[model samples]
Target chain A: MSDPYVKVRDLVTHYGTRQILNGVSVDVERGEIMVIMGGSGSGKSTLLRHMLGLERPTSGSIEILGREITTMSELDLYELSKKIGVAFQGGALFSSMTVGDNVMLPLQEHTKLPIDTMRIMMRMKLEVVDLAGFEGLMPSELSGGMVKRAAFARAVAMDPPLLFCDEPSAGLDPVVSRALDELILRLRDAMDMSIVVVTHELDSAFYIADRITVLDKGDILAIGTVEEVKNDSSERIQSLLNRKLREEEPDPDAYLARLTGTKL
Target chain B: MAADHETAGPARLVESLGRGTVRAVESFGYAASIFGETVKWILLGRRRGQAVRSGPIVSEMMDVGIEAIPIVTLLTFTIGVMLSIQGLDLLRPFGAEQQVGIGVALGVTREFAPLITGILVAGRSGSALAARIGFMTISEEVAALRVMGINPVRFLVAPALLAMLIMLPSLTVWADLVALIGGGLYISADLGMTMSAYVDQVLTTLEVDDVMHGIAKSAIFAVVITVIGVVEGSTVEGGAEGVGRATTSSVVKAISAIVLTDMFFVFAATR
Candidate 1:
């Protein structure tokens, strides 16, 4: 079998004295949509940062496309970063720039392509995110969904083989979230890119994840395909899934009342 | 709760002191690291035969130069009039009202213009630079730039340093001109000196060295303000309060550095 595109082994990270990721190990194959799902403060974001080479793991090793990122020089990292793209949770579009400028940033920095070609490529990327004509608009002018899409466009501008997104559906309506998930799947299949999404949303994770890595208290609880994770019968995963299911079920007040033998 | 708090007081105090010391050490380390990085980039840029890329430079020029022109001009004019008025008052006592022309011209061109402009820019633009970059650091935008393959110093500091290097001299020259004109008006009209006599006296008193001194001082002051602002801003921590503290400290440090450096320049020039 071919080696995984990204391999993280015994990764540990800390914020000062507080340990965040204890020893996370995961492998993501090429072209797969891997979801890192955990509750709040579960080190999911830290792991994502480690994977994207934003934060150095305190002890473990991260190899992206077989290069050890933790020890690489800054220039080498920069060169490697050109083949990878990231979409932050807040849609970190440069507030001072227009959507077009934001999308064209990587291309402008790394390529000497003619302006016309850059613009055409930028337009194509924007079109891929269903934002074909909103190129001139500033980030402040765009809606939350549009900002996410614009950020997505910028992430894919380099046509990187690996894409990392932190909380893709955060702060969006369910419909919009679903649309984003669909877009993620489309990008994966169409662009032939491997994607890693860090999220707490169960529905979003289940909807788009080809593989899921569940985290709890700085430890990986499970890492497997959707079916395997769902059917594993681990108490923590079951409880998490149950809690989500319980929250979604309608009107438990009547059931509680009947169980308690209380009269209205 | 009071009993428990009393029992924990010494331990808590020790812990707090320890944390504070650690933080101070960490901040010093960060500052050293940034200084080293700046030097490395300077070397790299020199080797590459290109100026370092800087976002802060463009933004600083827009904020400092374009936005500050009116206030700087106004202050220069006001200072000129005030200096002439004072010089006239003093000279009147000596029955030498005409000397006000020479006094105002010498003071404005050699000292007041550059000093006042430096202080103004240091207080206004320096604090703003500190606050903006500090907030950005807290927001992790600096880290974002790093991940995107752009050096923060190259992207943030180069522009600010370049802008101040260019703008401060320009501002000093403008301030010198405005101050002279305002002083000329005060001396000729208010103090009853003849326009041609005031003009000639001022012209005779003004030397090229006086202009050069002011511009040179302003340039040095600009470097001080930009360096302090960028350094403090880049070192900010703890979020909004940290940014606020950095801004305040940057202004204070820039002002102090400017004054001390100006005094050195004055001492050297006089010597």
Candidate 2:
């Protein structure tokens, strides 16, 4: 009944002269896990960045919690950003800070909570991510999986209603990846949060996603429930699901032009 | 073909000239933007209910200013002794070796003390700040800060700028005192002149304006170094190599900017 937590309409983005996202639109409902699946250069990450207002789109509008962010000023965007959390692919934890401090950073910045309360909350969040009692360690000391978990804890430190994760399972072992997927499910159920995950891992997407939006070359090829996406008749979708490469008709003229740096 | 070459030569020259001018303007604008944001956060971010934590600022002060005292003292002392020797050597030919006291006082207070401190801080803290921030930028920590609704400029650059502003003038004062003592001791030891006589000469030659001028230059130099370091760090590209390049550029730009600012100040004062 309520409006979607995020509404991205006909978003177009370009980097220099090249287009990244072309008229791509996506919606994420409240208390839903919407997985955005795409291969590299499919512009899934670009869309996520735009949703976070980290970059401006060439055209189209993004409304987060009913606020259009396309033209929002920096100060107003800061206000809007308070309700959202982003877990970057590389676990972007502040290297200078301890795990506990990193987790508590949002609380420290955005709230007037007492120091003791903040520390307790930080521990609880870390505990949720199965990183309890590892608060004193620097991010550099953590394993890759642990770093991603710590980053997740930091993102949800404020218990934001909306969360965006860029490639949460990337570069992790299968077991670690599965555990992270379970953690995402638990967080969503516990917090009643809306999560938008941009990932290319098919298993993780199928397992954790309430719905999947498959992107191909800056266009949405399919968006539906897991079964619907799996049964979709599009050859590209089937190819993605089967991990088969797309066969392209050769363009010898273009190939030669590229090799020779000349126009045909 | 000759006519085409003639036209292309002039066109290429004009294009490069325009590009260079554009780059220079963009760099100036970027530096000014950083400075403006830093000042805004330092002066106004707190009043608007944003807490400006003093802990980081104090820690930065210790790192940039207090921790630097030993090296600053050592180098400035050497410069002072050198000034004494050189001044005496030049004045001895005119049978005016006593004038070495005036030369040492004026030179140390007006130039050497602040200049040396500026260069040292630029090389030490500037490089570190740039590399630290650049690495953070490359690692996406800067973007993380943005997503958390914390202004990176407010959180990182403001404290650094504040630390530099407060500590640089203080360090210059320290440099001035130590340099004067070093020159005074050298003169007393070399000429068998009483320290009190050398002190009198320095006192007569030095004025409030000279000391103030050096302190002013140090403050400006502090701004230049902090701005360059923070700007380079924030705008880093590529990855680790980009961070390294940014650190190098920060130091080189800071030192160059400091010297140019000093020259401008001297020109303004003389005029």
Candidate 3:
């Protein structure tokens, strides 16, 4: 309802003994595209999963459109889920369903519209992703980029007010990733929706980010506009921008314990 | 210390067995919860489209029933012939070979057809259900369905439970009929008994209760097999090989549960 269409507060998450996110927080304004950039295990994807309500945090809250998702009932959650779409890193389309069926699924499941209208709606969504005629293709038949676009089509099929894209540019070539980044921007501008993109591509992040959230090993190193982030005086942000690795060496005992699958 | 070491092997064996029993019971409860949720979705839950349709139910029937007919028929037919030969030989010792008709009829209708069909379906369609759902799980299609506001239990498990319920009893009936026919033909050929005599004796021997009892057991077996498959599948982890392991686990679990259920039904029904 407010300017911050998405607000994450003090999100802490863990898997087994590993803490993935430690008090991470972020906010994305309505109609703005925020890019969350982090190295692997920095919790960008974990944050995305929490926002999508795919998993619960250890202690924190994610509010989408002013509703806390973690506490929603099953039916309530289903209703909320229908209003927010997600494009997974791996496309995550149903392999058994056709691209057309995959996109039409949301309409079919949620609407009383007839088959003809649902088909047209599906085609329109597919067209939005530049995958108009590829509707008949199965996910298995699509190339990596096509699969990504098809997944994007399915995610936006319901025309949700909010969308989350995880690693949309991760495995794509530069040209396709650029194209995807442009498409994401276009979706935000034309569809009047807020978006949060989790990616590691520096160029794409800087190119498309209204604000970039840099996460380093479960903590936010910086959060501001691309220029503001670049101008920030933190050495960690400087090292991240310069692609510098940590200079510290691993402890021998910890290394040995890790090698032996020992828990600390 | 020496005595403790000597007894450690047996002690460890008992401890492991006890743990295994607890794990099995826990898994059964897990499967039962999934089964309960699936039934709720099938009957009263909020999910709609695809799963509640007749299309999935029929497809599952063809998978669990129609496709299984030939093998079930073959297996039951072999057992029928074997039972006839053995029954005739044993009765011949007492000049009672004519009683083979009642013996084979009662055996096929009351227990053999249902038990064997249960085992076969558990091995065949049950494992297939687990593999399909497990692959969907590992590949995140199950999660995808969830994120899209569809319950995976509704989308995947409910149709399977419904289909198994519809088809298992029907398949058991077919098994009973095929076994009866096989034994009848064997008796006509091996003992010079007329087909009419064999048919008459079978019809006289098998009451409505006998047939209904077997069908009831088949329904229960269907429930057990379906639950185990769905629960094993929805919990699959690791990856591609996990799907395979889930399939095997479902089969083993379904068969074990099927036997345990059958034993319970046997005791309860007979009393």
Candidate 4:
């Protein structure tokens, strides 16, 4: 009923001359978990990067928390970023820092709190991510799952109102992935935070997503509740759900141009 | 048609040369931008709620300066001894071996000390900086900082730049003293000159301007090395092998830049 927390309208992007996202759009409501699902090269990650203002779109607009971000200045972006948390796919924790310091970085940068207070808050965030006692170790000492958990703790260090997770459960065991999904659910329900997750894991998506948006080749195939997306009669959706490869209708001219290294 | 065909090969070669010039200019522009942002952050980041952390700067000083002291001492000492030996050999025919003090003092203070220290730091600290930042770029740590509204230049480059600015000149002064001592030992021991006499020759031959010249050049070399390393590291692509390539490029570029800057300083000082 109210305005969505994030509104991306007709976003188009390009990597050099090749189009990555072509007029793709989606919306995320407050206190909702929106899972963006696609196979590799579906432009999902590019979409996430654009929403975070890491990359500017070739055209269209992105509104986050009712503010336009595409043309915002550095100072304005800093203000906006304080309320937005991002968890990169590879953890991206500062390797030079201990896990505790990494978790406390956002607070240290943005808050004027004392060192002891920051450390206490850092421990609390770590506890939430199930990494309470591992703060003294460096990120290299952590396992794959623990690294991901530490990265999550850092992202939510300031209790941001909106969280953007590139892929929370990617490359983890089923148990860890399921636990991450539960964590996502708890963050949304308990903290009242809106979340946008870009993932291709079907089980994780269905388990945590309030709504799912399916992308295929830079276009959205469907956007609806989990049940609504499942009941859709689109062949591409069916193939994606069944884990089957859909045969694409080939363009002979384009295929020939690609092979000959000349445009016709 | 004949004329066009005759000129085509030369024209293509010229076109590529022009493109390369443009690319080089663009690369310098990018480096200038990084340098400018680093200065701005160091000066104004605190007013904007982002303070450049001092812990990293102190740590960098240790890595780039304190850790480098022993090697700088050893190499400059050897250079001084070689200069003394060569000076004495040339002056011996004239029965003026004692004049070796003038040669060693003038040579070490005016040129060799700063040049040797610059090259050493380029190879040691510059390469390490390039590799460290290269890996961080590939791992998306730099991007993560940006996503958190933290300026990467402020968080990463400011510390190294400040450390180099403070350390390189200090190392040059240290190198000057060590090399002079080394050459003085030879003058006193083999040439039958008293230690105080050798010291007096060095002091009389050297001017404040000569010592200041080397220190000033060392400071310039420090900026060039730090900027080159940061630029090379941040632009690295392709992953681990890319990091290795960037580190090599950083050292090569830094060494070349240092030599060119030293030459310019010499030209200016003579004028």
Candidate 5:
């Protein structure tokens, strides 16, 4: 437990000429729920993308289970991916497949279990996500929150060592949001998996996070326990916690650069 | 101002030509890259591995080929009737109406059947491939597949390619048989000729090699149609509108490729 299960050192990422992550560094201890909190355009999603090895960083490194992901080959990365599960924000379930089939996909792909066993496992996972009888329905038939829960079911289907969830609480109602947050905490404890959740929902983040990392404009503003973050003295952290609207004066020449040929 | 305008006209023309050339080259390069990847997967890929499930392949085969039959039959039968009618009328002016049976047989088996099948199938299956793949891409299903360690080629494109290769030639055969029926109807009804006489003529005029020559072109057409569809579909940029655009362009590209490839086979096989 002393050693970090996932470690990032000086990660820099860029999209075209714009730097999306500016030397961000963080560590995720084993069996801990690390909630990445940031407002829109704060680069938390970019950081999550890096952690998942979905996008390559411009500089620095990520070590997942002591293996540097940036230098891993396709075959090696695939091997690494088997131990990691990701539940995308939009669910990203195959629209053509049934909810049951979607849940059974990773198992069917990775294991040679009998069809009956696979079906049983799928139903069990669905039961875990409170989608027990909804297996026959298509993704379109499910409500938005149900779809997210279904995604969560599929992500844990393989029992991966690490799990990543992107914006799980966004666009969900407060009741559904709280339910999902509780589900996340339950799953982490039950499965003993290290989880990383990226979201901007303050309530959900506070409820489930073992620790919180707040990001602002491509930089880490604060990193500590939930209580530490709530009581942190930094003005930026305080403003984020209070949800205060930014009040910066607009610059006119910058606006002209948008109208003119950017000659300013 | 007049002198500047005079120079700018030619300069604009040159710039436009340069841009057009670059765009054409880029498109060609993109097509070639996908073609190379497809060939690699077809030759070297494992059969239904962990990441590439067999269910989708079978489903795609039905989607891409099996469902395309009725339209193929109707269109080719119409073409055969038209060809027979025109052939007999044209030959009647020369007092060579007896040769109409021979002309229809050779034309349907050797060129028209395969050509018509290519066009129809390209429109049906090629557009479907593009639309399906483009929507999957926009929905991030493709990314999910990739993140799950699945190769898109094995999971999506290869099965379609394999299905097309098997189905296109089979469809061409069906087209040929249906076309002969159409021609037979025209021979007996309009020309007051015997069906036996037309069958005998066809049997002699159309050799095994002549039929094989056309069947070979259908295989080529299948490759072209499916490749264009997958390429255009997989590379879509925007949203729902992008899927629509990709589907349309894939159909157009498939048909154009079919026409050009058919011409090459026509000249080469005869020569």
Candidate 6:
């Protein structure tokens, strides 16, 4: 098989003495959506950071578009970043700048297009996210959903072939969340971009992900399609999927009293 | 058991020393990174001078010059008045109240005014720089800049350093004027010296070296303050607390470096 569009091999990441990702390995083909699902502290975000080259892995390597990102020089990595777009958690919009300025930043830095042309391109991207006239608004003026949409618009500003999104459905209502999921799907289909989404929302994951990787305690518990992950016999994955609560057995006296309907 | 205890005690001390050394080295590394980034951006600005000249430079002038003028003026005025008052009182005993003008003008124009103004600016603007950069560092904005194929230092520090270097001498000159006026007023009122007499004394006593020395020291001070602020701000970790600590430490370090450098200049110029 041809090399995957993005390949993560034995990725390990640490924060001080605590290991966030033990050994995460995954691959995504071109024009595919791969969702990394995990509970909090399951290393989903860490894995995504490694893939994006924002955080280097403590051990192992991440290859994006056939280049080892960890080993690449900063200049090379910056060039590589042009081919990739990332929608960070909370949208990560520059609070000081307006939406138009933020969206135009990458183009302004990397391209020599005329200002009027850049403005037209920026408006088009805003329109893609259904935020045509909101370009003049600051990040504070945007709702949570709008902020995410604006961030999405900025991420696709350059029409990158690869997109990474962290928790697209987070902090939004169900309707809005579904709308965002639909937008993600539309972007992938329209752009034919390989997408990697990090999230804990199973329903959203199932709706958007072509394949899913389940991380438990910094290790991948299962990797497959939604149906395959659901059917996997791994107890950890099963418990997480079912939302089973593990409660200790009650004391014998309490159990007996309850059964006999005695207050003593 | 005795041998084991002795070895453990020495081992712990060695480990502590090693840890401290590592932290210091890491700090130095962060400082170097910020410096390198600043230099890279400066070069970019030089290259892009033809294309994007006015916007970045104007923004920096607002940040470094317009924002800094009031504080520098206020401090210089206060220093001038206080120095004249103190000089009048001291010279009064010698029946040389006239010398108060010479003392205040020569001292302020030559040393105290610029040094004090530099320290104050370093504390104010330098700390703010550190805090701003530290906040950016923790927020991953620096990482974001890097990912965008933009060098963080060039994008952040270069403008700040360049703006300060450009504006500081002008600021020092303003401070000298304000201080001399303050000293003149003080000498006229407190020492009973005539305004004309005080002005004549100042004109006669003030040499070219005096003005040049103040401007030269201010340039050095600008470099020290800006570097410390940028370096400390970039090195910050651990979120808000880290930013706060870095700002405080940067101000202190900048002030200390200013004082030390001022002393060195004074010694060299006098010797």
Output the number of the DockQ-best candidate: 2
Q: Per-residue lDDT for A1-264 in model 2, tens only? A: 899999999999999999999898889999999999999989899999999999999999999998999999998899888899999999999999999999999999999999999999999999999999999999999999999999999999989999999999999999999999999999999999999999999999999999999998999999999999999999999998998989989999999999999978
Best candidate, TM-score-wise? 2
> TM-score for all predictions?
0.86, 0.96, 0.92, 0.94, 0.92, 0.87
- The fnat scores of all predictions, in order, read 0.29, 0.85, 0.59, 0.78, 0.39, 0.39
The sequence of per-residue lDDT tens digits that candidate 6 reaches over residues B196-257 is 88889898999998899999999988888888998889889898999999999999999988
lDDT at B194, model 1: 76
Candidate 1, which segments miss by more than 4 Å at Cα?
A244-264, B1-43, B46-60, B138-140, B231-253, B260-271
Docking class of 2: high
Stretches off by above 4 angstroms in model 6 are: A17-20, A245-264, B1-25, B44-54, B189-197, B268-270
| 3 versus 6: better TM-score goes to | 3
- Model 4 pairs whose backbones collide: none
lDDT of 4: 0.93
- Preferred candidate (TM-score higher): 2 or 5: 2
The TM-score of chain B in candidate 3 is 0.91
Q: Give the poorly placed runs of model 3, Cα more than 4 Å off.
A: A1-3, A249-264, B1-22, B46-51
Quote the chain B TM-score of every prediction.
Answer: 0.83, 0.96, 0.91, 0.94, 0.93, 0.86
- lDDT, candidate 1, A56-124, per-residue tens: 778999999889999998778877888888888878787778999989988887787999999999999
Q: Each candidate: what lDDT?
A: 0.86, 0.94, 0.89, 0.93, 0.87, 0.85
Candidate 5 docking: what grade?
A: acceptable
Write the number of the candidate with greater TM-score, choosing between 1 and 3.
Answer: 3
Candidate 3 lDDT: 0.89
Q: What is the lDDT of residue B52 in candidate 3?
A: 66
Clashes of 4: 0
List model 3 lDDT by residue over A1-264, tens digit each. Answer: 565879899999998989999998899899888999988878888888888888988898888888888777777777888888889888989887899999998998888899999999999988889998998888999999999999888999899999999999988899999999988988998899889999988899999999999998999998999999989899988888888996797799998899999987
Report the alpha-carbon TM-score of model 1 versus the true structure: 0.86
Question: What are the per-residue Cα lDDT tens digits for candidate 5 across B1-271?
Answer: 9999999999999999999999878877877777676667666665434333466667877876678888888888998899988998899889988888888888998899999998988888899989989999988788777677666766788778878888889999999999998988987888787888788888988889988988999999988988899888988988999999999999998999999988888898788
User: Candidate 4, residue A251: CA error in Å?
Assistant: 11
- Give me the candidate number with maximum lDDT: 2
